[model samples]
Target chain A: MSAVVITVTSGKGGVGKTTATANISTALAAMGKKVVAIDADIGLRNLDVVMGLENRIVYNLVDVVEGTCRLRQAMIKDKYLPELYLIPAAQSRDKTALTPGDMIELTNQMREDFDYILIDSPAGIEQGFKNAIAPADRVLIVTTPEVSAVRDADRIIGLIEAEGKYSSDLVVNRVRVDLVRRGDMLSTEDVVDVLAISLIGVVPDDESIIISTNQGRPAVLQNGSLAGQAFRDIAARLTGQTVPFMELDGHDSFMKRLSKLFKL
Target chain B: MPNDRIKIKGTSNGLVITLGAGAWPRLVEELDALLGERASFFKGGRVALRVGARLLSTADIEAVGQVLSKHHVTLWAVESEAEETRTAAAELGLEVELEPRPISPEQSRPTAGDTILIRRTLRSGQVVEFPGNVVVIGDVNPGAEIRAGGNVVVWGRLRGAVHAGMNEELGEMAVVCALDMSPSHLRIGDYLALSPADDSRTQIVPEMAFVHDRQIVAEPWSV
Candidate 1:
């Protein structure tokens, strides 16, 4: 089956692009799809660690691109899911070691074997980011609710549109419901209004995500985690499933709930 | 010196680099050397190359563009007297003439009639500048900017910075109007004003801004 290459990027750093890539790849694989995750952040490679495939990486994306190893040899199979694989980045090399042409060729060769190829793009609008999106069929931009993050996301959306490749979807991460309720943080509607893109997912700020990430197990594997559910829903939406967004305000005051009920 | 063959001057739109009369190879080499010498000053700057009466081919224009781009400068327009050069520049998506055409001696008097129309949203980091009035049919998000020599009008939301009557010689007669006026910064000639801090949550309504008593003021659009 042909694979749909999707690139996950954010102009600002520490916006959970790597986490989204790892969890979304896991969630898609759990759905019985053959998924291949590529870490396009060469010098700061962390997708392999997040995916729990760090120690198993014998070869990397640079190796495959440089012809030192075959594409199959560089792919590290997931310990839990038999259908999931990850092509880790070369920690010793930088972005210049791989070009956009190399990424396009690599994804094309693997298109016949996988159902979805998810690329975790590095932060910034540099060569690494270009390489990640070179072969993308769709783009997912992750950003926090902060003004700086939203502004960067807006710039990234403009850049992606200028490329004329694929339409991008937005995933607002690290959203604290209490802060939003207090009017101290930007809501999903505010971010969407500024970026003017379709909202694909809204991941709440959950402590379980940090714990699960440290354990080398993505939060999506945890059934009770809210962020995990968001990722799962995002994957479903990616597969053309229309899953309604989950209500993040679980601790809404009675007056607020009454107001909402009365308005309806 | 060979560097004297290339002259760079700052204009209202951007830098205008004039290539002196010489062979194409010599002119190109001198231009590259001049850019390399002042790379830091020219970094992230837009430029228009003026090649007087030269019949430059597409490849020649492209070569000049490549050199400028390497120095972190954008070649947005090409001003040339030759038809062939203008056609080559247009083929490469560069403007054939500099923007905000210079007023002739007979038409030196400033008028607020000429305007440029834009039909799309101006996202963050986008800038629209014109010599005459500007009318936008879409939203201007935060961080986007619009600078005009005369009045400015937005049929949609205008939440970005806008400078109307950029040419101070035209006096403070320019006005700015928008369906939802909440600009980060508003300017009329030399006067500048910021949106009130508490106006963010206010309901959207049609408004007009202009210079009143040497200060920028905004009022509900009536006429």
Candidate 2:
């Protein structure tokens, strides 16, 4: 099966690029699709830690590229999904150790083995960033609803366009729906207006996400979580499903509850 | 200096690098030597090579650009008689001109301030800033900005921030028009108007904004 290589990037750090990669990869694999997750953040390898596969990494992406080990030897299979695997980045090596050509060749070799390949890109708009995006058939930009995050997302979108990849979509993470209703936080509409790109997902601010991430299990595997549901919806949309966005506060009103019951 | 070659003059607009007809790599080496001779002088200068009759391809143009950029010079335009060279320059976002614009006394005089027509929709985060009249044929999405020195016109929806008649020299008069006008913020001269929260109601019709009684006011398109 051929893989669709998608790079998850945020121009600024801490906007949840790695988290989105883990969750989306988990969600897609749960749907019975073979998925491979690659951590492109060379020196700062956190995707492995987040996925709870840190100890399983004997060889890494650098080893595969350097011919020190076979490609399959570096892949650490996921604990939950048999079809899911992760190729962790090398913690000791620097970003300069690999070139954009190396990444393209690596992902090209992986396309035959998986249905989806998610590359967790490092922060910034430098060589590391270019290396991550070089092999991407699609891009998923993650940003918080804050002004700084949205502005950086705009710059990143412009850079992606400059690279002649126009199919990049956005994912708004950590949106507090309560603050949006109170006019305190930026709404999905506000962000979509600023970035001017197609929205793929809107994940609410869920405390469970933080807890589950610390436990090395992404929240997307937990059923009924709002953030998990958003990730699942994103996966469905990626698969060309037309799933409508869920109302996070559907239990707040009786009328909303009635509408939810009948699925009207 | 031993191998005689064509003369080139670098100007403010672009580089006028000259090349002599000879062996390909030798001519290219001569070109590089000329550029390295005045590296500081060509810094930040866009290059428009003047190749007299050289058949050059896309790869040739791109290689020169890479070499020039390493020396902090930008290849902006090219002047060539070869059809292949001109086509290659255009593909690389460079302008190919047969003759440069003459800067005679009359030609040096500033032309009348002209309007720039923007045909595409200005999406969010896109800023259109110009010193002359600006016309947009498409929607100005919210968070986008348009700062103009003269009148601004939008044939489509204008929901972004706009400042018309900016710059003190432009005087205290400006006009803005849109088919559906509900801008997040609108400024005419020095006055500002914050759009209402329910912009949906105010955006469904044609409107114009101008300074009336020293206040920024929105009026019906016909009025």
Candidate 3:
């Protein structure tokens, strides 16, 4: 099957790109689709840790590109998901180890085997970001509800549009429903209005994410986590499923409404 | 093309170099050699350029700047009859026109009657700079900027920072108008005015900003 490459990038760092990549790829794999996630950040490699595949990465993206190892040797199988694999980044190398051509070549080799190839792109609009988007059929720009994040997202969208190749979809992460209800934080609509891109996911700010991240387990594996469900919904949407958008602030529980009304 | 179309003249300000009609690369090479011939005399000197109808890109203008800077020369002002060259110069933060000095009066015509028109939404990090009048047919998003030597007009919402009369000579004559004007700030030549907090952005009002009594002011645009 031909794999659809989706590069997840945010212009600014620390906006949950790695976390989203880990969770979304896990969710997509758990859906029984053969998926492989590539960690494009060479020096600051963490997608391996987030995906719980760090120890299994005997061969990495750099090794595959540098001819030190075969492409299949670098593909690390996930712990429980038999259909999922990860091409981890080299911890010892910088982003220059792999060029855009190398990334395109790697994805081309894997396209015949996997149904979806999720590229966990490094932050910034530098060489790493370019290499990540080089083979992308579509791009997912992750941003938080903050103005700085949104502004950076706009610049990324502008850059992608300047390339005029891949279609960009926005995934707004870490949305605080409480702050939005209190009018202190930006809402999804506000972010979408400013960004003017199609929304794929709206993950609420959940503390379980931090616990899950440290445990080397994505929240998508959790049953009751709202953020986990959001990732699943994003995966379903990616497969052309008409999954309803998450009701982060809406469909609030009775207790949630009471707290919001009391705050108002 | 012929010999060298480069004419360098000394004015009250450092220098006024007029670039006549020729291929852009050839003109740039000629300018580099001409400045290199007397590097010591041009050291720490500011010069204004007059390129008549030579449509140049932002990179092209910066190439010229780099060629001049190689010889310790500062290319400050760029007076071009072409709208593209002027916009490129203005985008580079160089003065589109000199400070009301006797610039090249013999270069076909001035940029007074010229205007640049952009028909796209200027997103963040995108800029629109023009020597004369500028008319944008789309929204100017936040973090985007427009620096105009003359009047500025936006057909859509203007939510970015915009400066009119950047050349300072037309400070009083320049007026910036927009439909739904809620810019981050407004500037007219040397004067700056932080946009008044426009809370009621829902109600659209076409307004014009101009310098009056040494202060920048915005009023409803009736004309």
On lDDT, the leading prediction is 1
Indicate the worst ten consecutive residues by lDDT in candidate 1 chain B: B103-112
> Each model's C-alpha lDDT?
0.84, 0.79, 0.83
User: lDDT per residue, candidate 2, A1-264, as tens digits?
Assistant: 899999999898999999999999999999999999999999999998888888898999999999999999999999999999999999999898787767877987889988999999999988788889877889999999998887678767756653446678899999987888889999988988757689999888888888888999998888646788789999999988999876755525633564576685
A-chain TM-score of every model: 0.94, 0.94, 0.94
Question: Predicted candidate 1: interface RMSD?
Answer: 13.7
Model 3 CAPRI quality: incorrect
Docking class of 1: incorrect
- Name the weakest run of 10 consecutive residues (lDDT summed) in model 1 chain A: A250-259
* TM-score of predicted structure 2, chain A: 0.94
- Which lDDT value does model 2 have at A130? 84
For residue A47, give model 1's deviation from the true position in Å.
0.7
Q: What C-alpha lDDT, on a 0 to 100 scale, does residue B62 get in candidate 3? A: 90
Q: lDDT of model 1 at residue A85?
A: 96
Q: Which stretches of candidate 3 lie over 4 Å from their true place?
A: A251-264, B1-57, B60-120, B166-171, B196-204
Candidate 1 lDDT tens digits, A145-228 = 999998888778766654444379999999999999999999999998878888999998888888988888988998767789
By TM-score, the better pick of 2 and 3 is 3
lDDT of 2 by residue, B1-223 (tens): 4135547775665457776533344456666777788788877776667776554656777877787888888776767764435545655657676355554324322222546576655655557666667789877876678888787899987878999888666635778999888888988778888998764573377888888898888878774
